[model samples]
Target: MTPAQRRRAAEQAARRLARTSLFRRARHLALYLSHGSELDTGPLLRCCHAAGKAVYVPRVLDGQRLRFERLVEDMPMQRNRYGIREPALRGARRGAARMDLVLLPLSAFDTQGHRLGAGGGYYDRAFAARRSGGPRLVGYAYALQQAAALPAEPWDVRLDAVVTEKSLHVFRN
Candidate 1:
């Protein structure tokens, strides 16, 4: 499916999950702000802030890694090479707080719970290095991004759960 179709599906899926009692229970959430061709998360972010959950957004850094930065409505934003909106950062943000939940954007996912990123390996590598007791990984995607299977490499990390517009899928591993 095209990226647009995938995004629409994922956004609808995330909206459904956001309205669920389970997701509403989270007090602190780590949510990625969407960039070009990714699932739209504007509504989700607004819903989270309005619900009084502390929202944490990712800032891409030099190491092909991510650092969690507290997202405030007043923060300045700029477009990266990929045309995704991101907050400007003076330095690399630090530490992983105890997040009650996390929402991850994906280019693709498989029934086996593997994620296919956009080839940068940023999310894969960061997730591998994250040792703090924060939110569990939950991939957010449109149902169209679902694949029958994905090739998992040694460094590729799996998700604890995946939520598509059609359903919320949890993995046991």
Candidate 2:
């Protein structure tokens, strides 16, 4: 399918998820700004901002490492190395707090709950390191990005749920 088609599917899915209890229950959220091929988060971000919740975005720091900084109104944004736009905070290397919810960008995800990232493993390491007592990991993907299978590695952490524009795929522990 075309990029537009994929994005449309993902956007619809996100809209559906926005009405869910899980999304409504979240008080603190960490979400990504959608670029090419990722699920659109503009609506979700606006909702969070309007709700007066603390919103954080990731800044890719080092190899497979990312730092999350709180985003306030009218915060300056910068283009990161991955071409994703993130809120800029100079000299702000504070560790990510234990968020109530984390919205992940997914290149691909499987029915079995495996996620294929952008091949940099940034999300993999970030989730692994922060997920011990952190928020629920939710993979945001277009329905077309769902696959039959994905190659799993040790550092490749599993998600608690995968959200498409259609519905939430909650994994059983």
- Clash count list over all predictions: 2, 3
Winner by lDDT: 2
Candidate 2: residue 171 lDDT (0-100): 83
TM accuracy, model 1: 0.83
The C-alpha RMSD of each candidate to the native structure, in angstroms, is 3.0, 2.5
What lDDT score is found at residue 87 in candidate 1? 76
The TM-score values for the models, in the order shown, are: 0.83, 0.85
Residue 42 shift from truth in candidate 2, angstroms: 1.0
Predicted candidate 2 versus true structure: per-residue lDDT over 105-129, tens digit per residue: 8888887778887788777777666
Off by over 4 Å in 2: 1-11, 91-97, 129-133
